[model samples]
Target: MAIDITVDHAVATLTDGTQLRTPFWRIDSDRDGHHLAMLAAQHGNEVQGIEVARRFADLCAEQLVAGTVTLVPYANLLAIRHRRHSSDLGPEQPGRESQGFNMQQAWPGDPDGNDIERVVYALDAKVIAHSDRLVDMHCWNHFWAAAVLARSDNGVAVQMAEATDLPFVMWRNSPAPEADIATSSHLMYSRGGVSMAIELSGQYQMREAEVDRGLRAMANVAKVLDMIPGEPEIIDGPMLEPLAGNDVVVEAPCSGIFMQSGLEPGQRVVQGLKLGHIVRDDDLETVVVRSPACGRLWKYGRHDMKCDVRLPDQHPYASEGDMLALIVQACGPERE
Candidate 1:
C-alpha cells in the first residue's frame, strides 16, 4: 500500500529578523496505529542522529506497514549551522549563560521568547505535541559507547530502550522537576507518552559505524512499534543504574597530557583499578588515574574542553580535577 507523506516547515523569526525554518517529514501508512516521532540535532554538534532521522524517514516511505512517523532531522537549525552545541545569537540570560541557546533545554518553549525558545516552541506545538512516542537522538564523546537513556518507571519507555539493542541502557527513576524539564523526551514522558533518548558515540562529524548503529536502533524501534514488520532484536548487555550519590569519576590529579591504560568504555573494572596516567607538564611528574569503585566504565577522555569537532590525532590534555573516566554501577534484573 502507498503511504501518505507530508513535508512542512516549522517557522520562527529570530530577534535579528532572520527567519528560522526547520523542515519536518510526516509519513502515514494506510492503516493507522501509533504515532512515533524521531528528532535529531537538538545539540547542533550531534550530527549522527540527523542522519538516522533522515534515513529512517526514507525507510518508512518504502516499508511502513502501519501508523504515522514524523522525522525532524535538524531539530535545532541555528546550532547545526554554527556547528556548536547552541547558537550564540541570543543575549546571555542569567543562569543560562553556559548553555547559550540550547534547544534541548527549551522544551515546550515560549513563542515570544528568545531565538532558540521561539524555534523550540514552534517545533513543540507543530510536531512533538501531536506525537505519541518520541526518540530524541543525541551524541556523546568519542570515548563513550552508544546507549539508550530512558525513565525506569515508564514501562513503555523502558521497553523501547531495550528494543534498541544498544550495548548499554541507563535508567532514571525520579520525576523531572518542572524547572528542570529541559529535554523533549522528558516533556513527552510527562504527558504520559513513551520516550527515550539514544546517545550515539562521537559528534561534530558523522562516523559511518555510529550512523549505522543509529539506523539499526531506529529500525528496531519501528519494529517494536509495529510501524514496520518483525520483532525487536534484543542484545545482552549491562542495564546500568545510577549510583546513589554520584558516579565514580576519575579525574586528573595534575595538569598534564593524559595517557590511557588500555581500558575502554563498557569494560568492567574492580575498585582501585588503574585507568590511566597523567604526565604533569609543569614538573614532569606522573600521576596515575584509577577507578574509585567497581563498575562499568561509561566514558573516558579529557574533560572541561569544548568538543564541538572531532580530534582524531590530537592528544588529550587534562587539568587538575578534569574528568578522565566515569564508572556506572551495573544493576541486575531485580532492579527492573
Candidate 2:
C-alpha cells in the first residue's frame, strides 16, 4: 500500500491477471499542509481527466515539495478500454448495478458491494480519506463542452473552483447528495475535505485547446493548494459567479438525429433560441430543438452539425432524457 513517489507505477493486479494503473504519491515531512488527490476516467467516457492526472503525477513526482498528491489516471479501466461511460455497460460485469450513474457517485463504497463499488471503497478509504482536497476531472455529455463544479460545501467549492481557472465554476449544492448519490467530489466533501470537478472538452471528443485548459486548471489547483511553487494560473474564459444547482440542461425531446441550426458553443443564447433540429433516423421527420435559457454552449451536440463525423466507439448516442448540451446559465434558477 506504500506509494513510492520514486517510480513504481502499478497499484494493483486484478483477479483476471491484469494489473491496475500505476499511480505515484508523495508524502511531505512538513505535515502542516493538505493531502491532494487527482482522479480521472471514473466514468469511462470522460478521458480528458486522465491526461490531467498523468501530467500532474509526473509534475508532482518531480516538483511537489509539501503535502501529498496521488494521481489515479485510470480509475475504471474496463470502461476505459471498452470506451464506454459506465462500468455497468462493460462486457465483464454486465449485470453489476451499484455504479448508479458511473463510478463518480458511488462513494464510501461497500467492501461487499459490487465490483465497481469495491473499487470506489478502496479509492475513498485508501486514497481520498487521507486527503484534504481532490479534483475529479470529467467531460461533456456529447460534443458540447463543459463547466467545473464544486459539491459538498459550496463555500469551499468556490475557493477550489477559483483555483482551477476554467469556464464558469458553479456549486452543485452545499449538502452532499444522500450517500447513495454522493459522487467522488462530494464524497471528499462529506469527509471534511474540499473537492472540485473540472469539466472540459467532451465525453468522446476533445480539442487540444480544451485539454490545455484542463491541464492549466489542475496546475492552478496545485498552486492554490501550494502543492506547486507558483500562483494559481488564471482562466481567461468567461466565468460565472459561482452558484448552486446543476447547469441548465436541454434534454432530448425525442429519439432522433440532432441537427444544429441555431446557437453554437461559446455563443450567448436567449431563451427560445433555435437550438437545432431532431431528424428521426427512421423516417427523416424533423423536430425543432430550442434553448431553455440564456447562456453559451459549453458545446453543441455533435448530432447538431457534425453527426456524420462522430465515431460510435468514441461517442455515446444520446436518447430522450439525455442532456444534449449545457448552458452556462446567465441568470437565476427560476429564470432558467
Candidate 3:
C-alpha cells in the first residue's frame, strides 16, 4: 500500500500577538476509507499520548492499507510550552478567575475568543470537523491504571472503547452534568461521529510500557475500523466495566502525610479494608484510611493539590477532604 503523508499546522494568534502553530500529520493511503483523528497532550503534563501519536503516525505511514489518519501530537501547544495543565494567562475574561483556560473544555471554540479558545477553534475546523472517528488521548496521574472513557448511550462510542482492548472501560454520560464542559471527544460525539477518550497511566514523563500499550490500543482501533488488516486481538483478562458515578472516593480526614498501603490497581478488597494511613503533620497522629465500599481499588494518591515537584514520590502530603483513594463497584467482568 502506498501512503502519502503531509505535515500541516493549525495556526492561531494569541492575545500577545504571537502565532501558535500546532503541527498535525495527515497520512492517506491509495484506497479511500474511514478517517481517524487521534490527538494527545491536551494537558501539557500528559506527554505519553504525544509520543503515542508520533509512533502511530510513523506506523501508519508504513503499514496502513486504507483510510486517512490525522495525528496531532500536541493538541494544546501553549499548555505544553508552559508545562502545565492549562494555558490560561490569568483569566483573560472577567468573573472567571477560577476557571483556568483548559483546551479540553473549550471545544467548538470561538475564533475571536481568548487564547485557548482561538486555538481550539482552529483545531476543530482544521482537524476534528472532518474526521469520521476521534480518539482523544490523555494521561492521568500515576495512581490509576489505563482506562477508556466512552459515552454509555452511544453505541458507536462504546464499540470504539471496546476496540481499544484496555483493561478498564468507564461508562460516562454525554454532556456530563458534573463537568458541564465540552471536551473534544464530546464535541465529536455530538456531531454524530464516534469518539472516545483513552486515559493512559502516569504523567509528567513518558514511560516505555505505557507508550507500547497506547500503540497497541491505537493499532487495535485501526484494525477494528478496517483501516488496517487483521482482526482485533483478544486478551485473556476479563475487562472491567465501571459506571461513572458508582465509585467511592475516600478522602483524607485530616491534613497529613499519606502513607499508602502499597495496594495496586485492580486489586480486590472487601468493605472497610485498610487502604492507607495519614500521619498528621501537626500532632503526629496516625489516621488510618479504609475503603468505604466492597470493590476493587481503582486509584490511590496523596491528593490533587499542587505540590512541589521536588517532593519525594512516597509519603506525599495530603490535606483534609483531599482524595486518598477511589474504590469502584466492579461489575462482573466481560470478555470482548
Q: Please, what is the whole-model Cα lDDT of each candidate in the order they appear?
A: 0.78, 0.65, 0.78
Tell me the lDDT of candidate 3: 0.78
Compose the digit string of candidate 1's lDDT tens values, residues 25-143. Answer: 99988588888999998887788988788778888988899888989999988877876777763322222353547788888888788888999988988898988999999998677
lDDT of 2 by residue, 1-336 (tens): 222454334344444555455354444425456788777877776787777666666666666666777777777776677677775564423223434636776776665655566667667666777788888887764455456877534666676687666656556666625545467766776667788777776666556666777778877777777767888767464566423343687787877666777554555677898888777756777777788887666656744443322345224345676566677676653243
lDDT at position 61, candidate 2: 62
Q: How close is candidate 1 to the true structure, as a TM-score?
A: 0.77
Residue-wise C-alpha lDDT for candidate 3, range 113-151, written one tens digit per residue: 889899999898899998989999998767777888888
Q: List residue ranges in candidate 2 displaced over 4 A.
A: 1-31, 90-101, 176-181, 241-264, 267-295, 301-336
Model 1 accuracy (lDDT, Cα): 0.78
Model 3 steric clash total: 0
- RMSD list, candidates in order: 4.9, 6.8, 5.1
Worst 10-residue stretch by lDDT in candidate 3? 89-98
